[model samples]
Structures are given as C-alpha cells and as structure tokens.
Target: MIGLSLNRVLAVLIKEFKQLTRDRVTYAMMLAIPVVQLTLFGYAINSDPRHLPTAVLAQEDSRYARSLVSALKNSDYFDFVAQARSPAELDEMIRRGEVQFAVTIPGDFSRRVARGDQAQLLVEADATDPSATSGAVAALAALPDQALAHDLTGALAMRGQAVKPFEVIVHRRYNPEAITAYNIVPGLLGIILSLTLVMMTALSVTRETERGTMETLLATPLEPLEVMAGKLAPYVMVGLVQTAIILAMAATLFHVPMSGGWLGLSAGIGLFITGSLALGFLISTVARSQLQAMQMSFFYILPSILLSGFMFPFRGMPAWAQWIGEAIPVTHFLRVVRGSLLKGQGIGDQWRELAALGAFVCVVTALAMARYRRTLD
Candidate 1:
C-alpha cells in the first residue's frame, strides 16, 4: 500500500485548483452558464403567455362592445394589436401569425345585452402553439361577468346578476385538441442538429491542429476551399442521415405531421445543415482544443433550447432576447422545419428563412477562412 503524504496531497490539490482557475473560459462557464441560464430561462419561459396579440372586429360602435374589449385588454392576457374589417381578414391574421386571438363582436351584441339576452362573442385563437393561448382562453371565462358588471343598471340589472350573461365562442385553431407533441417534435430537429453537427465540426479543425496533422496538411498544395470542403462534406452527410432518422422517429413515435413537399423540406434542412457546419468551423478557429470547442458549443446549447422557440413561444420572450434568437441559425431553421412540416409551406412560403440560412453560411465561412491558419504558425 502507498503511504499517505499530507504535504504532497496538499501541494497537488493546490496545483490542480490553480490550473482549474487559470482556465478562465471553463471556470466562467461553470459559474455563469448554470446560474444565468436558470435565471434567464425561468423568466423567459411562461406556460401562460400574457399580452398576446389580438385582433378586434367591431362592426358596431356600441359602448357595450367597447367595454367588453376593454375588459379583455385589462385582463393582461390580450392586447388589441389590429382591427380586422372582415371575418376573412381576422382568419388571415391568425393564419399569418400576426395575431393570437380575433375578437369578433356581432353588430347586435349591445342590442342583445340591452334586452337582457345572452350576447355571443366569437374569439378565434391561433392555437398552433397551444400553451401560448391556453391561459388567455381560460381567462376569457371571467370576461362576460366582468363586462356586464358596471353596464347593467335599472332594467338591465338582471344581466349583471345572471350566472353567464354572454357566450364566449372559442375557436382553437391548428392543434384543436392542444397536442404537446405537435409543437415539440418539429423543434427537436433543430436542437439535435445543433448539438451533433455544430459540436462535431467545432472540434474537427481543432483536433487536427492539436494533433499536428494540420501542419502536414498545410505542407500540401491544398487550397482553403479544398480543405474546407473535405472537412465539411463528411459532417454534411452525417447531418442528412441524422435528419432522416429524426424525421422518421418524429413521424412514427410522435405522430408529427410532415405536410410539405420533400423537395422543399430537404432544401431548407440542407441549407440549415450547411450553415451549422460553417458556424462550427468558425468556432473551431477560435477554440484551441476539443474541450474548448465543446465548451463553446455548450455555450450555445441553452440559448438554442430556451430562446429558439423550442422550450417556449418565441414571441413570448422580451425584445432583446428575441433579437438574440433571431440572430441564431436554429431560430430560422425551426421556422422552416415547422412551417414546412406542420403547415405544408413550400420554398415560396419559406424563402426568407432559407435565405437567412444561406446568409449565415456565407458569413460564418468567410470568418472561418479568415481565422484559419494556412501556415499553421
């Protein structure tokens, strides 16, 4: 048995701690990532979304109609963002994601209420992301009583005391049954691709450099484009295989609907994969080792999951965080994947996201090429 040496053990412990502290990036990540991610995600995530964008279709100028709308506005769940002139306009707003709820007050709402009759208010909710609108839908129950509370007086007093004075016609669109998997399975594609492709490529160049193979490669007449293509091609293939597997699993296990044409979906996912590879290549230029590459990749993981509409509604986040999410490649990719898979959106419908991914690839590739050392000096 080896003899225990207190002094030697103490010396080793101190040396290890010093080395650990010297690794600023690792130490900062250890301290900051957990705390910051927890706090940030806690505040950013809301199962019950508040101040949801709402469209009002008021054909009547009745005080009662205005009061009912006011009640919804005051409840902190709905914010009247637009006024739709027709039912078709309101439905279009919901489809385009311009608004979450469309409140339609029939022209005779005030007349019905004046006669102590139950007035019907149609609230059509874009429930594609059911979690976002559930709270607001539940909150609508209190509106009828609250709307009539002050308005009912003298002969109209019976309306105030009625158990239910108005009917809230809730039309939950998209996932009408409010399926959770409908939202999650599509998002997993982005998250998985980000983890595998980004982290793998992030370490690719760094590993070669650390092993001194980069020096040998630079001795050859290979141009940067050749080198980049050689390194990226394998990962791109891997990404496609992974994409196929995930999509199959999503369809079979989660019953995720894949609605769009295969060509459009493949094009979008292909662009996303290319962009992720470029981003990882850029990270590889900055990272000195596999551990550093992983740390950098891990730095993005939380933000991808939390801010990219994966764990929560994207529009639910604050403006600054939304801006950050918008800058991330996964955010755009999620839109492409989800829109194509869920809504049957083609390239014409999702061209902007594909273009954004293309732009990301260009920018990251440029930065990576600039940072990549040709001479390995």
Candidate 2:
C-alpha cells in the first residue's frame, strides 16, 4: 500500500505543470534564448571581418597607382573611406582606428616600375585586431600583378614582369602572429561573467519577494546598503572564481599570454564584477517578479554580446555604433582585458578602462540604491 500512489503523483505533476504554464517569462526564455543565441551567434558573428574603412595616399598620379587603388577597393576588404593628403594624415587615420589600412603609393612608382626599378608600396594596417587586418594584408601580395596587367603590354611586353614589379610592405603591428585565440579568449571573461553574475544577482532580491521574505527583511533593522552588500559580496568571490577558471583554461588550452600585472587585471575584474552586481541589483528593483528580473537581465545581456567587441572588431563598426558601444560596460572591460592580456599593458596603460569601470560601478550603485525599496508595501 505504501509502495506507490498513482493518483497523488499525477495530481502533484498536474499542479507543477499548471505552475510552469503561469510563469510565462520562464517558458518564453526556455524557447527563445536558444533560437536568439543561435541566430545571433551564427549569423551576426563574423571572424573574417570585411569592408574595412580605408584611406588612400596616392603620391603618384599615374595610371598604375590608380589601378592599384582600384584593385584594393575591388578586393572587398578596403572600403576607400577617405583620401589622405599626407603621410601624417594617413598615420592619424590609422592611429585613431578610423581607417584599417592606408595605401601609400610613393612618387614615381609607375615610372620606377616601367624602368624595371624595384618599387615599394606601403600598406599600413591597424593590426590591433590581427584577424581583421591579416585577410586584407594577404590580398595585397597579388595586387602588383593584377593592377599592372594592362601596363605589362606593348613596349613592356618583353619585360612584362618588370612593368608591374612592386613589393607590398605590410605592417602588422599589435598581434603579429595574427592569433585568433589571442583576440577571442580574453573577451570570453566579460561575456561569461556578465551572463552568470548579472543573472544571479538579478534574481536575489526578486527571489526574496517571491518567497515572502521581503516583508520579513523590511521588519528587520537592515538598511538597503547592508542588504545590497550582503547580496553582492558573496558573488564577488564567485566572480573571482569564474575569472580564475576562464584564465586558467585560456592559458592551458589556448596558450593566451598574460603579459600584464595580475594586480591590475584583478582590479579590473573586481570592478567589473561589482558593476555587474550593481546592474543586477538595479534590475531586481524594477522587476516585479523573478521572471521579470530575468527578462530585464537579458535586455542588457544581448546588447553587451553584440556591441562589446567580443565577436567582431570594435573599430570595424560605424561611428554611431561606436558611440553606443562606449556606453556599454563590457566594451570598456574588453579593452582592459585585451590590453593587459595580449599587449602587456601595465596599470598605467590600463588606467583609462579601470577608471571607466570604477565610474560605472559608482553610477550603477547609486542607481541601485535609489531604486531599491525598503518595503513590499
């Protein structure tokens, strides 16, 4: 008789099923997150970035120089965004990441080539994100042959090779090896922490309300600051643990070098975690239920994924998009993580990002404290 109760079990199952149906946000997340993540990750995320903004500094007004410029544009890598008046202007463009490449055709390039003299072509690329620049740089090697095909005829027929003989000197700075993992692995830290820490803290206050504990907390002497600290302090440790795991795996598996000081990186990570916790707390204040908290968290999460330079080069996006990206916390964090991890940037070099994250934490904390209600009434 005590072995099993079929009716009771069915009744409990039915009750649970009904409860599941009422949580519409949870139900929708179960179905929507996969489709949305798959769609965005599969389609929007691109490794081999294209249509890069480029500036041309064509010193010689020869047909061959013009052809080379045209060939570069036709390559689909460079978009020919501007014409540089001088090398300094071109350098400025590349420095600001306003242009990925600057094609500098030296004076008398065609004349030098027509006379079979070795001509040097300078293709300066913003190699900060090596993957973005490498593809375009490789295409430059064949430019001399393609651009001078028309010139390598008639009187140049006998010396066809000489008519278009040019050397492409590609300048790949920052990441010289063009390692994809170097660019990708460090960014994973921001993304994973955002997903976990934000969502976890987003649920904390909401869970208290759903379980009838919010009123109990209101009855106690605890202030909102105390509650916020209690909720976020443990998660700070959790974030540190997550950081360690990600960094360890990145180093052991992908061989990502940690050239910067750990103290600097740790400070950045701690600040980022604090900021994420503050954001989550702010969400908890707005959401009426735990499910609403989760929904609100995703509202922030998706944008962070798209605009944070994790999947694509940050500078590759348009000016308007870059402005939007700057508003995102993850964007600044990505800069710090990548700079310290790959470029060996010291604390001084990373002060800008650290300062931005610190400011962000302060802002979010103020907003969270302002939004947090002391009572369920």
Candidate 3:
C-alpha cells in the first residue's frame, strides 16, 4: 500500500514539473525575476544622495570668495563643476541641466568684511527635484562658516583687523530634511498598484481564455461592457485588499507615514486600480494567449519601472526621458501619492494628478470596452 501511494505522489509531482517546464516564458520568469530584481534594487536604489553638480558665480576674486569656492570643492556631496561670470550664465547652466546648484559671491565680499559691514553670500539651488536639492543645500550650509573663518584669520594677519559680521543663511524651501523615504515611498505606491493589478488581471483573463471558458461567457446573454465589469469587479476588491496590506506594511515595517485622510487615500487607490485594470483588460484584448499576455505585461512593466520617479528623480532625467514618463499613468499617480502622503497635501493640491489619472481611466476603459466587444463578436 505504501509503495503504491509513493508511486502515485511521484507521478503527480512529475506531471506538475512537466507542465511548468512546458511554458518557456513562465520557466524563465521563475528563475530570472529574482536575480533581476536583486541586481536592479542593489545598485539602483540609493538612499544616500550625493554628487550634486554645483556651479560658482564669483564677482569677487577676493580671498573670501576664493576660499568659499575651495571649501565647496573639498566637500564630497557637492561637485564644483563650473564657474559662471553672470547670473544669466548660472541660470543657463541650471536650465541646460549642466548644474544642480549655483553660488554667487558679491564683488565687495572681502571689502565689506574688512570694514566690519555685513557681507552676504548668495546661494541658488535647482528646486526641480526636492531630494537632490536638499542634499546640495545642506552641503552648502556647512561650507560658508568654515571658509569665512579661514578668510578672517588670513585677513587679520595681513591687515591687523578682527573678523565679524559675516553670515551664511541657507534657503531650502521645498524639502528641507532630504528625507529619501518620503520621496520614494509615495512613488512606490503607484508601482505596487500597477504591478499587482496588471499582472493579476492579465493572468486571470488569459487563464479564462486558455481554459476555453471565455468563449462560453461570450455565448451568454451578457454584453461586453457587462462582462468586462463583471471580470473587473472581483479584481477591484482584491486591489483594495492588497492596498490595505501594502499600506500596513509600509507603515509598520518601513515607518512610512500617511499624512492624507484615509478617505482620500482610498479614493486615489481606487482610481489607480481602475486605470491599471483597464490597462490589463486592454492587454488581454490584444494578446492571443496567456504567454503573449504576460510578455506584453512585462513590456509595460519595464518602462514604467525605469521611467517613473520611483527609481530616480524625474527632474534628474533628461528632457526626452521626462516626456516619456509623462505619458505613463504611474507617473501622475506617484505625484498624487507623494504630495498627499509626504507633503500632507489635500485634494486641491493634487487635482492635476487626480485629473490625469481620471483621463487615463476614461481613455483605457474606452479602448478596453471597444476591444472586448470585438473579442465577443
């Protein structure tokens, strides 16, 4: 009896292995995803921000200005890359994406300090990306005092005068703390939703088609819209469950705070899931088989991962890359999630992103319904 039972179990295991090995795509995914995910996350995910390109616009060639520039160069965080003769040159460098920050020292910087009058150092930072900007600002803040002290001691030795009345105040408005998690977690929400919903819907739809059940459903009295709605309703519920799980994990495990109201977060998640599921339905309509559906889903997932603000700050990317990101629904959803959760912004602040998501849902839903009807016919 024991020998017969063991033989039966071995036969079942062998059959299951054969079935799994038959699908080349699934076999590759099973082995490749872990390695790919590990490598991508290991090198690309950097919580410590550095190497911010910085420019100096010094009108004064005095000891104080030169000293400040030297101090900036010595710091690891700021890369002293360019020297701008005028504000226009500095602005041009920043706009042209050559430099992330610029510092200007007035012509009378040394003269004012020697005479006991107040000397001000002007610092300009690119506020396009809040995370990079904060790092640059913090590095700049620590430099001026050290530079001024060196300048003061040298000036006293040369002209026999005391060093006083020098001030360096930092003006970092957008993101003061340079909190990496605050910037990334919000973007991650969009990515998590997209991956879960798209994969789930794609597999579910393809499974029905593969099993020859979709044809039976089409033969029923239900319209395409009704069928699509029915197919999506269950996943929408699953999306909500997944959203809650993710939110809890983010909060408890990662210490990611949610500053927005629960209702607003729920609404945003619903819209995002609607858009993602619609996209999945569109993918299902075009794909001929389950393997094809997963392949198409992967094509979508790769670009979204790279181009979205989740991996890298959108402003840091070149203009063409930024334009590509704008077309993705995940990009807009990230903006909404980040603004609400990290910035403690309300619906009014995120209306533009919300509108973009609404537009995505409308467009994708229309396409899915049209394609679904054709499939039924």
Candidate 4:
C-alpha cells in the first residue's frame, strides 16, 4: 500500500473548501438556517402567552362586575376586545376564533352577591390549543377570592372571609379534554402536504435540468402555465392521497373527531396543494440544481413549521413572527383544517382563511410563470 501523503490530503481539503464556498445557496443555508432557528426559538416563541383576546358579555352594570373585569385585566392574561351582546354572540365569537376567552356575567350577579347567594361567573375558553389557555385558566382560581375584595369590606366582610365570593365556572370549549392530538392531528395534514408537495415538485423539475432533459422541454411549444400545470397535476393527486392517508389515521388511530364541514375541508386541502406545487415551481425556477432546490425548500419549510402554529401556539409568537406566519400558506391551511374538523366551521365562517390560501395560489402561480424562461437561461 502507498504511504499516506499529508500534502495531497491538504490540497484536496482546500479544493473542497473552494467548492463549498462557490455554492452560495448551500453556504447561505448553513449560516442563515441556524440564525433563523435561534432567533425564532429564542425570541419569537413563548409557551406562556399573555394578553389573549377576550370577549365580555356583561348583563349587569354593577361595581362588583366592574371589579371582576378589572381583576381579570390586572392578571395580564385577558385583553377585552369585544363586548358580546348575547350568549349566542359569545359562542359565535369563540367559534370563529375571534377571542380566546368569553366572559359572561349574569344579570343577577350583583344581586346574588349582595344576598350572599351562589353567584356564578361563566368563563368559556377556546381550548383548541390547551397550552395557550392553560395559564389563563389557572389564574382564574385566585380571582374568586380576590376579585371582589374591596366590595365586600364593611357589611360583606363575612362573605369574603367565611365563604368564597363567587364561583368562576370555566367551560372549555372544542377539545374540552385538552387532548394534544386533537390539535396536532389536523395540523399534521397541512405540514405533511407543505413539506412533501413543495420538495417533490421542486426536485422533479430541477432533476430534469440536471439530467439534461430540460433541453427537450425547451424545444417544445408549451407555455409556462401549461408546463407548470402539467408538471404539477400528478403531484396534486399525490398530495391528496397523502391527505387522505393522514386523515384516515387521525380518525381511526387517534380518534380525532371530524365534527363536520366536509366541503370546507376539501376546499382547503385542494387550495393548499395547488399553492404548495406552485411554490415548488417557483423554487425550481430560482434554483440551478436539485441540491439548490432542496436547500431552498428547507428554507421555506422550517419557517412554515415553526411559525405556522404547528410546533408552537400562533398567538404565543411575537407580533413580527405572527405577521410572518400570516403570510405562510401553512398558517391559513392549519386554521382551515382545525376549524373544519374540530370546530365544525363552514365555508361562510372560514372564508377569510380560504381566501388567503386562494390568494397564495394565485400569487405563487403568477410568480412561477414570471420566473420561468422557455430558453432555459
């Protein structure tokens, strides 16, 4: 055997470094990905979210009611945004994800408190994401004792010390069991589709260029839209099959409830699949090789998974992160899937999310067409 040569090994090491530095996409990925992960995980993510939007339905305008609301605000958890007029309105507000909590104070609240009778304060929490509401709900335990401290001073001091002031009845709506699977299973559908469809389409198109089959495509008379649609059509079926498989397992294995809204569910899945494929096509146009395409896909996929409320609470993120998450199609798709399967929300109820997904499809398709060059430049 030949003796080992350190000089020859050093020359190869320098050459490999030169090659690594030349691939800007891979080089940027190595640097950019770690910084993004650190920034998001360190600053953007929060497990104990505060200032959650809460809706109040106050039927009595009494000092005690005011004190209770003040105490809730002091806790820094409930931010009263809307005043629901009725119980039906309160239910609708939480169902549509307008508020994290619904506070309903009965008309007889002050009267019952005065008589030392059993006065109840109802707090309905949107428990779709248990981690988001768990802290706020736990904080409510202390509210009953101290919420009306100043009110029960002179004549009502006995009421405060002898017995509890009033009961804080917390009704955990949708996923009342606080099952993590209920949230995760529906969200997986979006994550799975985004990861697979985007990577697959990007790699498929870039592979043609790498293998020299793109020249044959360049000689054809196909328009950019035609080429994109044709290339993505089969992948749409693949995405749908993946969706069906995940959903079936979610139902049978996890026993995740499919409340209703099949039409909305189907619409969301179709739009997301189309958008993901179009995004992949856009990536293919920018990437020079399959490796670049893969790197770019991970660049998009990591943020989508992190910021789209898949791995963390959407509301738990900072304002900037939430804004970025809104732009990602996965965020809207997650809402659509969760709303339809968990909340039984109809198309009318979740039109905004569907509109966002539809807009993503249109914008990405346009960008893909604009980026595509028939000359293979």
**How does each model score on TM-score?**
0.91, 0.75, 0.63, 0.98
Decoy 3 TM-score against native:
0.63
* Model 4 residue 372 lDDT score: 88
Per-residue accuracy of model 4 over 1-377 as CA lDDT, tens digit each: 88999999999999999999999989999999999999999999988889999999999999998999999999999999999999999989999998999999999999888888999999999888888899999999999889998888777877678888789999988889999999999999999998999999988678888999889988988777788888999999999899989999999999988999889989999999999999999999889999999999999999899999887888888899999999999999999898899899988888999999999999999998998888955
TM-score winner between 1 and 3, please give it.
1
Arranged by lDDT, best first: 4, 1, 2, 3
Give residue 281's lDDT in candidate 1 (0 to 100).
89
lDDT of 2 by residue, 77-101 (tens): 8889999999988876675446778
Q: In TM-score terms, which candidate is top?
A: 4
Clashing pairs in 3: none
Number of residue pairs clashing in candidate 1, backbone atoms closer than 3 angstroms, sequence gap of 3 or more or interchain: 0
For residue 240, model 2's alpha carbon misses the true position, in angstroms, by 4.9
**Which ten residues in a row are the worst by lDDT in model 1?**
155-164
The list of candidate 4 runs beyond 4 A from truth reads none
* Rank list by TM-score: 4, 1, 2, 3
Q: Model 4's lDDT to the true fold?
A: 0.92
Lowest lDDT block of 10, candidate 3? 156-165
For residue 3, what is the lDDT in candidate 4? 97
Better by lDDT, candidate 3 or 2: 2
**TM-score of structure candidate 4:** 0.98
